[model samples]
Target chain A: MSKSLSYSSITKKIVLSLAGLFLISFLVVHLLINMLILFDDNRELFNAAAHFMATNPLIQVFQYVLFFGFILHIVLGLIIQIQNWLARPVRYNRKGYSELSYFSKFMIHTGAIIFIFLIIHFANFFVIAKFGHIDPITYDSGNTYEDLGLLIIKLFEDGIYVIFYVISILLLGFHLDHGFQSAFQSLGINHSRYTPFIKTFGTLFSAVITLGFISIPLVIYFF
Target chain B: MDLTLKIWRQPSTDEKGKFVDYQVQDISADASFLEMLDVLNEQLVVNDEDPVAFDHDCREGICGACSLYINGRPHGPDKGITTCQMHMRRFKDGETIVIEPWRAKPFPVIKDLMVDRTAFDEIIRAGGYISVGTGGMPDANAIPIPKRDADIAMDAASCIGCGACVAACKNASAMLFVAAKVSQFAMLPQGKVEARERVQNMVSKMDELGFGNCSNTYACEAECPKEISVSHIARMNREFFSSKLISEKEK
Candidate 1:
């Protein structure tokens, strides 16, 4: 940290950005796993994969790292937000102001919505899969495992949960759409020639993530 | 061209302001925006009504004194161009344009479109200068700054302190202004000696002056007539952090 730097603002941003990128990487891994559900003719393969993720020691360690990252990311984001609010301490009452883009102005609002979505997601998937009593399933080899497929079906069967999943995925997509390229710019990766490409890549990635996640619920609900 | 102008008229900083309307007829489209204002003021003087008071010195746009929020933009709709350089042709005939002073708390209205931008002067006094002793001008080649660094430093130095950055900022931050000054000197060999103190003092002063914090919206860069990069803000952060760390270690 530079002595002259206002760490409260800049460091918070750096931390949030790096952690955000880490979480995005985690999301890619997660999306890949969930997409495996689409591949399995039966629910057995998906359940086995879920079982391995839950039981593998190395995977457990990775989960802990992810948990820490989430905590740090959220804490830093909150601190920065509070400090920014404190710094302003007043509001303008002008009727007509201009030059602000719609997306630029609503970052915090979108961020808060995403935060709520994460909490709901964790409760539905992580907590239930890890600690909650799941229905039993017997494999062809006579080994019994927790039925993650049934849990997913139950969660998506409800019309409200389906709506929630779609809304959350959309908000996540919106957040990632802005956050992906913004992180690169903040880290000083700006080369005018490559920025447009990066932005395009970010948009495509966010769209894919959103479409992939939303597909799971949509498939379960309709099928 | 004929135009209807709704100009802000505040008797003083303490008084409530109101928009006074004026119609100007047969103005040249090629006339600069300030020249159009000048013609309006000239007519006002002849009519014995108080002329609209605005600040301008170098009509060439170098002085950073002409600050106007034309139709809600800091320096008007044109990108990388100051108000003095903007011409009347940018507007259609019979258009009603609203002109207001820079609306930041730190930059209080002095009169019509003129503002007391002494906050900038104060931030400079807080340490925007190299503290080297008076001596004969050294040869430019003696410093031997890397070409890349020199170019970056010159880019930062191009900030004209027009208060456009502050006005464009949603939070009305002076970070872009202060960062430009800090980064310009911090980059050069001549400025390296006092880099620590320069950034520290200037930033602290900026905070002290009630300037809002940057939220990374990039509005300042968008509306800046000089187009100073937001990268300078990052450099300012880097300098301030490292300097504070070094001083802490010494302590």
Candidate 2:
């Protein structure tokens, strides 16, 4: 009963994991930029960072790369998900299926919500700030479009958008809480002694990402 | 001691199953878990009531026929033991035990706590073998397998093809079981000739049988009676990928 190869299942997992890691790196950079809003009161430095990101030649190139990376990540994630769904077409009807961690079972739901959030996030911040007309603010170097503060304030002022943002951030936390260490394990990094530490690190990273993003709306609404 | 049991009962594979409660009294704490079931069955037979159906063969824990998802954990609360090997002492005097068949879609229940685990057999039939023909026994020392490889093969061979790995997995994945089978054969000299084909065929059969993909949660390893390492899954991935590469090169 010698079997033949269908496809490389691991390749799909590896692709999804690498893409997730890339997105994590993007999160770190994005967080660094957002944290600057806390520092410069006048919004000049924020605008400068925005301008550099939008207009600088190297960053412009990187932006295209990031876009491609995001697309690849989403496509690979969906492919893996579809394959998984096809593999087990039937749903378990029994209760207490959540004996395993609730977060692990709800990954698909969390992932879908995060996907929707990413779309809204890109439309609101990236598209409006990049291509759409926003209020212009004059800086020492030059003039850069700068309505992000106003946009943030307006979005948060609407309680619905605020709620959606909060919920999405929470779901993102849930996704990362599992995804972080899972990606490591998928790449064969599971030493029993190190796995606990890695899981803790993963939890910390999820908390940071969730709290960091949630703070932006809080800062806008409160301050 | 009186024990309350909520056992899942289904007439056939087509009909939906539901939990039915039964009570048994004065059961000894030291009885093996299957013996407790036997006591219940004896009561049923005497009373002329239909006895609860469950799967068990050796009762010594070697045959792997005893499969029960008891109280949210596979094979009761104890680790490193099958359901048949579990003792009644694990439960309190008046405690209630919830028993159900393995809940994977591939392992459909034919009766109370008895599931059709033939999907596993089908997957094994798909590729779990070496094509070498049986002949007279060769020289004892000839074609020696390295100590490490032999040890690993033994570890992999420890799997009993029980559906516990699938039952224990959050995704109901058969990866650990399939990996164990593939690795057991792949480690031996006779199996080397068909290693690539074996992995590929077994994986295809696994997929065709509607077992979910492994999500690397390690739940399979956690609930496995044999404590099969997740590393075997990694090996399966490596073997499958390399086989694909080699096959592509041939093309």
Candidate 3:
């Protein structure tokens, strides 16, 4: 059967790459804002950054795009994976792991776990900031903002929640390690000169992003 | 040296298959892997049992007919060579080797180890040719093609229609094989006219044949007897994308 013009394998690959990279960029912005916690002793700086992200009109518009990007990336990823699974109906009895990396083979596993974590993340923070009631914190400088930072700190105080957050961050890192370079390859962006660099950058980006996110729950829990 | 083989055997295509253990003794290590199989088949004939069935033509490794998944790798545990080119010396004395046919929905086994690879022919038929008038061969220098393009075209032309790329792939994708054909024609002047339709039709046929998507594992290159580059896959993707866009605008 002829595939639809818009959702062919090539088109799906291109969409996956572009949306994946957009989500990666969002990670950078998110990590930057999140890093404010490490800078100041109190929640004022972090709250100010969070408040800016929550209230800014431009970021708000982009936030919808970011959500759409995530859903698109995820749905396309599942479609490709399902078709891949059906392409080989029979299972290999003595399957070898010689040609594929762990991240490449285990993408679905990591992605599913990450999806659950994302729902929890949005529920705990995003939903509450937008809809649910949150107490206001008054600063000594006569400034008042939502006490979202204190809520985050309290949520991290639970060892289980902190552990869950750290584990999920690590899984996200594993997904990104293969994802960054694979996106470029799927988009037909490849060269002997730059591919190695992209692979290296992928690994480095995964580590930095995971470490940055993990530091938050660890710090808020123990310190 | 004596060797033990755990080879997959199925009575027919519809029935389930299982691994059958057989012993072959005093075979020369210098003999090719297929030659050793020939010895075993001879023994089976003497015992009044049906001999093992596998595919082969031009055992020197050029025809790309011999395909076997030996020890969990396509074309045996060697690099850049077909199963017919693999030597028995790669296996140690008394080693137990596992052999199976290509594992993919598109490649169904015809017998013990021979699979129906007509799906590949269908993909090629979809667009692997340049139409020309029925006349005398064109003059050699009439087209005046660049040397670099010809060389790369020749490189892409190295794919032997062997399904190792599909066998080696975790997803059983034929992207590398399809890509090689697409790139071979896309780089040539004679092929430029049908390049767009060639890639599109071939890709659609490949998809319709139930082949998987490329996940960039590079397994196809590693297992291919021709060592076809994965870059061809990327090039084909670029071609397919541009062709789709152009076709859409034309529509």
Candidate 4:
């Protein structure tokens, strides 16, 4: 029993929605920067964007915010999942599972898988680029920075890792399928007219973003 | 119509229960669902066996008393109807039916297929009422409510306190039930005066009673006998927000 559980859970819903929406925006930004990999002769373009993201003062602050968003979303999701489990102490004898959509039924499952993927991804990329060893590259005259672009290309070149990335990205789609529309609904921004649009766009957004992320690994592996 | 029934039976609240299979024969296609249950109960009584216990009062979909999860949907397969209103014709002649009680921590089984839904009563007591003055009946048009508001209020007021929404919800959330009560009053001027405290009190009590928060799954509304819209939940969210906002401003 958490102390905060006594108050109205509306606060938790609002916070979860806000944090989730923030992370959603972060995904778009991340995809835009990561998309630069598809360009020709663009190690500089992608690396510079990555360097700016890592070192820019505003982005530096936002990096911490992004980390906080991840922590808050995961914690809130776990708490809500546990609360739901506790709420239904008994399971129905038959035919209950067919009632909920696959995405709705496995939200916690997808979220947990995404969390595990995030841990591995951050440790492999973010931590190394931040503190651990990465070979530095020098430009025209003076500037030298970690070659995160090269590290990413190298990581994605491995077929096993690429397969894992593809599967994880699809799992992220499952998470986003329910989460995007659900966030708006939780925050009380729903309407009869716009709700359908929101659901459609959320599905579209999740699918495109998933394919975009998966494209990076596939291109690096096969192309 | 012949049917195979898989029914849950529990002797008491603490005892473990299991699904017992029974074959019912020569059932009329037009018989109501509860009437079919009556036919089965009659057989049990004839054989000198204990009859299955279930709760029903009005038996006309008005009373929330009839609570049964039929074939994974609350109140049976048919939509916009309670257990009492569901008919045997909804199923195929040889179809097998699975029946169970509403399984949630707040709702415990008092007997086979009958759960103690006093949790809903507790929520209503929290703040689902307006304090009114004692007086003789006044003119109905005195308040001069707008047609739109009155219709919405009526729609919300139709909630029969059936735990179907709770039983149908994947999280076993009572959002539909509480939101209906909250909205029933939030729309009418009579309920507006206590809106702030009403939303706050009722939601807290719902949580304290172990009802899960709304995941917006919509299963509750899908299986609801009254067909109460999930929009009430969004409205309740707004009410809760304003409640917090106004009370904070007063401080």
Instruction: Give each model's whole-structure lDDT.
Output: 0.80, 0.80, 0.89, 0.88
Q: Which is the winner by TM-score between candidate 1 and candidate 2? A: 2
Better model by lDDT: candidate 2 vs candidate 4: 4
lDDT for each residue of candidate 2 in A1-223, tens digit (9 for 90 to 100): 2222233456666667788888888888888787766566667766667767887898888888888877877776666566666544434434434233447666778888888999999898988987888787776667655746556667887878988999999998988888888777666566658878988999999999889988977887777
Candidates ranked by lDDT? 3, 4, 1, 2
Using DockQ as the yardstick, the better of models 3 and 4 is 3
Q: Considering TM-score, which of the candidate structures 1 and 3 is the better prediction for this target?
A: 3
* lDDT-better candidate, 1 vs 3: 3
Clashes of each: 13, 3, 0, 0
Cα interface RMSD of each candidate:
3.7, 3.3, 1.3, 1.8
For model 1, the superposed segments whose C-alpha errors exceed 4 Å read A1-7, A52-102, A192-197, B18-20, B42-50, B237-248
Comparing 1 with 4 on TM-score, the higher-scoring candidate is 4
Best to worst by DockQ, what's the order?
3, 4, 2, 1
Q: Is candidate 1 or candidate 3 better by DockQ?
A: 3
Which runs in model 4 stand beyond 4 Å of their true positions? A97-101, A139-144, B248-251
Docking class of 1: incorrect
True contacts kept of each: 0.12, 0.18, 0.62, 0.62
- Tens digits of per-residue lDDT for model 3, B1-251: 99998988988889888889999999999999999999999999999998899999999999989998898899888899999999999999999988899989999988999999999999999999999889898788999888988988999999999999999999899999999999999999989999999999999899888898888888888888998888788889889988977664554
- The TM-scores of all predictions, comma-separated, are 0.85, 0.86, 0.96, 0.96
TM-score of chain A in every predicted structure: 0.88, 0.87, 0.95, 0.93
Candidate 3 per-residue lDDT over residues A1-223, each given as its tens digit: 3343236677788888899899999999999888887787768898888888889999899988999999998888888898899988877767855575568888888999999999999999999999998898889888888878878888989999988999999999999998888888888877879988999989998999999999988887777
Which 10 successive residues of model 2 chain B have the least lDDT summed?
A: B242-251
